[model samples]
Target chain A: MDLEFSPEDIAFRDEVRKFLEESYPESLRGKASRDEYEREDFLLWQKTLYERGWGAPAWPKEYGGTGWTSIQRFIFQEECARAETIPIPPFGMNMLAPVLLAFGSEEQKQEYLPPIIKGETFWCQGYSEPGSGSDLASLKTTAVRDGDEYVINGQKTWTTLGHFADWIFVLCRTDPSAKKLQEGISFILVNMKTPGVEVKPIITLDGSHEVNETWFTDVRVPVANRVGEENKGWTYAKYLLLHERSGIAGVGRSKRAVERLKEIAATEVSHGEPIIHDPTFARKIAELEVDLTALEYTELRTLAAEAQGKGPGPESSLLKVKGTEIQQRLTELTLEAVGNYAAPYFRGFPKDGDNAYPIGPGYAHMAAPLYANMRKTSIYGGSNEIQRNIIAKAVLGL
Target chain B: MDFNFTSEQDQLRDMVARLMREQYDFDTRRKIASSEPGWRPEMWSQFAELGLLAAPFTEEEGGFGGPIETMIMMEEFGKGLVIEPFLQTAVIAFLQGIIGGEKIFGFAYAEPQGRYNLNDLATTAKKDGDGYVLNGHKAVAHGGPMATHFIVTARTGGDQRDDKGVGVFIVAKDAKGVTTRDYPTVDGQRASEVYFENVSVGADALIGSGDDLALVEKVVDEAIAALCAEAVGCMKVLNEATVDYSKQRKQFGVPIASFQVLQHRMVDMFMAAEQAVSMAYMVTLKLGEDDVERAKAASAAKVQTGKAGKLISQDAVQIHGGMGMTDELNVGHYFKRLTMIGQQFGDVDFHLKRYAKLSAG
Candidate 1:
């Protein structure tokens, strides 16, 4: 089987590369790669992309998106990743937007889609609670109907970008007596500014403030905000979870990491020569490259299936498990390349400060931080252990 | 972009699989194991007639002009416990394709003290007249008992540790002062050690001499790919046999396959086999590229496949209970073949160390 891209796809890739090279601000690229972007800086960067009609390539054009084919979208993302440009955050665009497009009422889509497209509103996910990760149906979040409005009172921990969000899509139990656990849930949207909404930072091992514990107490949301039918939130949640897991594959980002690792290996000396010259290290890189190649092919298979107008089946779990593993390995290898330079634990280094003593190179300060930050990949979007179980049950019928 | 075999390749695989099932059954394999040289010439002739032996070589050398992936197909054949010298023949064909000659060649690099290191040759080759006089003994030469020529490696100039000075020679197996001690391995394969007492050969016998240890390394790496592919095939058979036995074999008033934990273990075996197959395919694809890159990819596949083969074989045996360890069952044959394949072209640790060194660069 061949692995070469079509000439047209290559040309599209070139166009994407050229656009990213010219349009993506150097400051944002540097900060994004360093995992040091502030909320405002991210908004500004996303707005610039939105203004250029380059944001949300995977979304439909009728909803202020580019309406690209799956391969084109894949190409766009890969180029952006290889160029080290700021990524369009998945919470709003990749995760919730698809749900809004497919299941949200027309007026609801009209109200929320424009804001997301214009970068006027940031979104966060409210799927997981204290007790409901892999066994997500056991969630304790509650939404009670009270005349024209529903009061949402629950807590969502590990809320990525919750502090910056103006809106959130949550899955809460709307039916206490429904027979099946999956039949008692409902999907609803809530404004972050609603009364009694609070976001408390949950500091991760990386010492980053990207995640938070969001609590909603007596938060009022109009009945119009509910997506689809009542007690059908599990269906919508499953749909959204697929989107989340698919993006979690991170094929583009891993490709970029491999490139950056190669560059660093070429420059860094290990045994009186560039580390890239070391046969062992080169072989390790090559091994990762082979894995990355296989992952890329698997991704293409998924995309090709989507192009044929089908949602991902059990094979998506395979992609999710292997893709995240590869990304984790890439991050580990990146840190390994930096060696002792990545050993220092810089807690909360400012994004725009001059106080931090940059380690090894300007690029290396983020190695440890990136490694620490990515520790949650396997935990979120379904843990690898959970994915294995899914594979065993769904694909192998075991 | 596509990850499927062509219709022709598909038919070829199916044909080979059917032929293996019908003609090369377990009883036939046992007979071959007990034979004089532990191999059947009629089987080799059958493969040659089927054009399987010539699939991986070029038409210029009486081959099909196919790529290394063709050789991978033959490797899978070896995994079915087929008692034949496919690897020995394919490797000779591959070297002949590269060296551009009709001369028969058998690899003579592994030494008693070298420990699977291809470049660690101790034999010396000194210039005498218009040729070189080889003075050393080569051990564990597969197919050396029947081959017409020997592709011998000898220390020329550099230090023992210096891989740069190793030279490769194609010496006639029947040359004067040549002696052989042939025997059967535990896996029912024949191999021999040959002594070189001033065995002289013309300068034309040298394939690619001098400090080109890289080429020598490539030959070894390619051989590893072939061996890994064979192991993959063997693992596939073992996995399928285990699954079938688990479904049919009963225990505690029910089929053993009804157990969830055992099913999960079998699923894991399937996953390992699938991953190994994917990596082996990739290694075959990269075989004709840059030497270092090829070596790196080949070593990764070799490492992964070697380890996975061992695990799957062991698990297959465990799934069959006591029957798996007995000589009457085919599962035991796969176990022995997998063990032999592991040590054939540098074991898992050797490849992993190689992979780590290349990656650490």
Candidate 2:
């Protein structure tokens, strides 16, 4: 019945807050936006957490995880988002690890889990292809098994952080002759530096290289690299997608963005007053806050259900759909608040030895790009439309 | 009672559509938008040759058309998501540069302190001898970088927000004290933070005399209508593109368009685009009405178009899925342009309140 955290949880929140305050790397302090984050920046933050034994907060305690309670995990995530920490990319820790934990062999777990948690390697997802985004089971990436290894061949587009990733978890068609399209697919890992692997950056509309089209021209991988039984990777992938959508409802980050939006609006002038003073702009922010509150409660309810030993169900798709809409709306409002400054597109702001000052406010540098880039939220992670499809069929049984 | 375009307007649309197809395809437009000048002077020459430069002026002013011509032209421009400054230099303002394709022009009305109020100008032109000395920053002057000349707003008499003091001045971009920091906009167009430090202009440079806020507002209303027309172009293109894409793109062994859920969405997009087309035309028809009616129509059309643009663009992107996200596709370009148009002169909320006020009165 209570909405407030327990006393112990509150204390744990404070402890985590204090830990972030003291231990968050000094270099990563002001670089809240992802534009400034290099591979080293992410590694620094992840390693800092790894050093604190908090790298994989949601993993089981036996798998080098803190094994915090669901509420504690929620609190930790909230604090990290509020602090605007560079997110630990989900490829290794969130997506692949869960798949590995659920379906990997003992040798695979023993070999990979420690390096993943220790921040020794970066992993990128390889489920999507040019022809196979929403229709993921129709993927054409093939893994023809050699005597001792699998010869993988196909291109995986939108491989987030593929440019610098140490490894990629690819979904390959191990048995193309199978009766069902979903049945032939197998989740397999590939090294990015293998003989035929290629990484070509796909510049987004924002003119930034956050994702890439990763090519594998007959790359080799040991047969041991496959997760779970052959022809059953669809089950494991669906499981991972469920895990992906759970955190896609980014209420914590959206709340922080709201506060940031308010600050920008307060500073931006409209009719001799701050834009926030304008009833219309104020109302949009208020509506956004209300929407975020509803989403927060929905997330909290899911977390509570998890605490009660129930897994997040098809309803988590609601969070993905709504959360992405809210996030997109945040970008919209931010661009609105920034006003005419949104016109200026900075390809790379204040690059090395380029001391030319940007034309507008420092906050405005990334406003439009972030707005353009944030469109990926709904499109990625099974798209908001697919999520809606999930809600219609799975939730409503229509 | 007539919503149909005149024969001339239809010819204009057909001509522009042909030029856009032949010369302004998606890749060419993208290249020019990112090129050294960020726009095509040659395109301006073609527009000028096609009599587009003088289309908005009265017949007395030696032009064959009015806002309707702009509406027709901008709609086609929207379909291509044309990156050139036709909106900036023609409908939004104008370019005498069309002759030699040399003298680009921009409208500098917005100020740092003025959100959407066309009258809230802090830039001033205090009279000195045969000219006036101008000093103030014009925020994000549309087509500012390429513009060799600017139609700027400055206060001649009263305080910042007062409607009575505003004066319009056409100043040369290279005026002694003028400086510009040019940058490409998010929508792949170019703009500048144009600063005026005692920049001087002759008395002749002033367009029509004192208290020009009403003139500015009227021009803005026309511009908003023109923008609405352009947005409808974007929405219609996007809606159709989404339909085409969904029909081609398959998921679950059928075109995603086959899903009743998606079918409903495309229907919504189509309907929104249709309603927006009606509003754009309505506003154009009302552009010559009395002040209050014109203002109301403009605001109402802006609100309709802005809200419609949001839905159509987002849904278009959503339906196209990841392909919509890539800069390689035309969908994202159209989406970005539609997004920028939402906040161009006044956003949906601003126009909503404005429409409400005018309606009450």
Candidate 3:
């Protein structure tokens, strides 16, 4: 019932704050604070946190993590988010690691865990095929059994960070003739360096190459790399999807964005006074703040359920839908705050050679890009429309 | 931070909700609305007996010592379209208790030209020998016609636009030269315009000495909180009614709820209700603290609740199709109540302006 942390937790928070102040590289913090971190910068930040034994605060201590309590983990995340530090990539820590910890063989854990903790491996998800997003069970990615290895052949579009990834975990149809579409799938881990694997860039409307089309052309993966039971990959996939959806709540990042929005609104002027002085805009921010506060409570409830040894259930879908909506609203408000500074399309901006006077700052250069990038949040992970269906069926029993 | 009510709060809510549902059903409300007084005094006495009337007041002032959160629970009272003076009575009770008054009281703030601004008072109270002579007319004064006493805000010195020098007085409803033009509002509740023509009051009538405008502002802000809670209640009913009607009513040989568009809209309605509930709860928690903070939070809730209540009620009626607008239908009651709730305390634009001003500062 109490909102305040204990004295010990407060002290722990102070220690974490001091460490963040001293240890996070200034250049990396600058990029993170500006929301313009590159792949290398993110990796270096992750490695720094890992070296300090502060990476993956949600993971068990035995897995080279902090193993903090749920509230402590939440506090750490809030602080890290508010501090504008680079968040550990969810593809490695939030999405795949949990699945590997739960369903991978001992050898698989030993092999994947260390590389992930050491920041030596960069992972991208290979889940959504072109025709099989919300209806994911209809995926046609085939992984034919070939003696001691499976040959994967299919395309995974919207592969976030695929261009930077060295590894990919995929769901492929292993037994096409199984009764249920879900029954035929198997989870496989493949190296991006395999001879037949290819990645083609998909430049988004934001004119950023953050996403890619990953093609697996008979890419051979070891049988030992298969997670859990063969053809039972649907279970593991569901587990991973829950983790992904839960992470998509993005409470920490959104809180930082809200603070940034407030700051920008306070500084940016419209109608003579700062835009934040406008009641309409300020009211929108206040309403968003209140919604974020409620979302935080909903997230804590879900985490409390997990702390009691329960997997994320249908309620996580609710968080995903509302969380992404809030995130989109934050971006919209940020663009509104930036006003004319955010008008130049990223593609229209000069990139090389002679004419290259940046319109505002590097941050303003990414506003349109970030806005365009966030357009996929509701579509990926699972479209909010699909999440509502899940909530209707599972939570509301409609 | 927990979002759950304590077991005792839950029990209290359940008891009040049940009493409202059983005793103040739509049929009973409709019957009372057509009666001479427009509201049933027997029901008010029943609420008093159940301690619902005293729920938000302190024990020393013939009340149950309930926090503002208890007023939020009273939102359910609005859901049933209960025709009683819970809000008017409770707010006045709290104010009177705070200012050391023993009698039941009612608020008189809204004026014919005030629009929705509580600060736009044209009333004047001039100092007389050992007392004050009040001269003003107040509109939409809920329970003013029946209240034992009235808390009337009047400009003592400064200009009408200046909220400073605005003083609040406790005048008995039966004070000399006081007259009430009472009538039933569209929501089937009675409110009155009380005219004070040189109505003199004793020294004790003044709640606080000289121009403490902040106290008057605080009272108005708390009254807005009470209204927001009631609006949340009204919207909750509207949401449920919409969902239920959409589930049962069939079109094209299937329930309308089967359509994704309607489902999404219902989800939106649910979200609005959820946000309003959260904001109302937070404002209730801070009610006893900072006045400015309470004003900001309450305005936030009012803005959200007012808009949501209107949207949900309108959509609920539309979802019910033709029967929704009929006086015979219960959903229409919710619709009427929601409309009334929006206009009460302050409407969406009023609160939004207030919120913007506070946040801007």
Please give the CA lDDT of all the candidate structures. Answer: 0.74, 0.86, 0.75
- Model 3 lDDT, full chain set: 0.75
What value does the lDDT take at residue B265 in candidate 1?
81
**Top of the candidates by TM-score:** 2
- Each predicted model: what fraction of the native A–B Cα contacts (within 8 Å) does it retain? 0.00, 0.76, 0.00
Best by lDDT: 2
Which window of 10 residues has the lowest lDDT sum in candidate 3 chain A? A353-362
Considering every candidate listed, which one attains the maximal DockQ? 2
Compared with the true structure, what per-residue lDDT tens digits does model 3 show for residues B1-361? 7767767667778888898778878788788876677766666666656766666766776665565545655687777776666666666446544222234456787665564566667888999999899998886677654567777888887887676788888888888988886655546666667899999988888878758678877777777677777878888877888898888766444676988887988898899889888877877777787877888887887788877876787567655553453456677667656755765766665577788899998
Flag clash pairs in model 3: none
Predictions: Cα RMSD each: 19.8, 1.9, 19.9
Interface DockQ per candidate: 0.01, 0.71, 0.01
> lDDT value for candidate 2?
0.86
lDDT of 1 by residue, B113-143 (tens): 4655676667888888888888887767776
Docking class of 3: incorrect
Query: Which is the winner by lDDT between candidate 1 and candidate 2?
Result: 2
Q: Write down the TM-score of every candidate.
A: 0.54, 0.96, 0.54
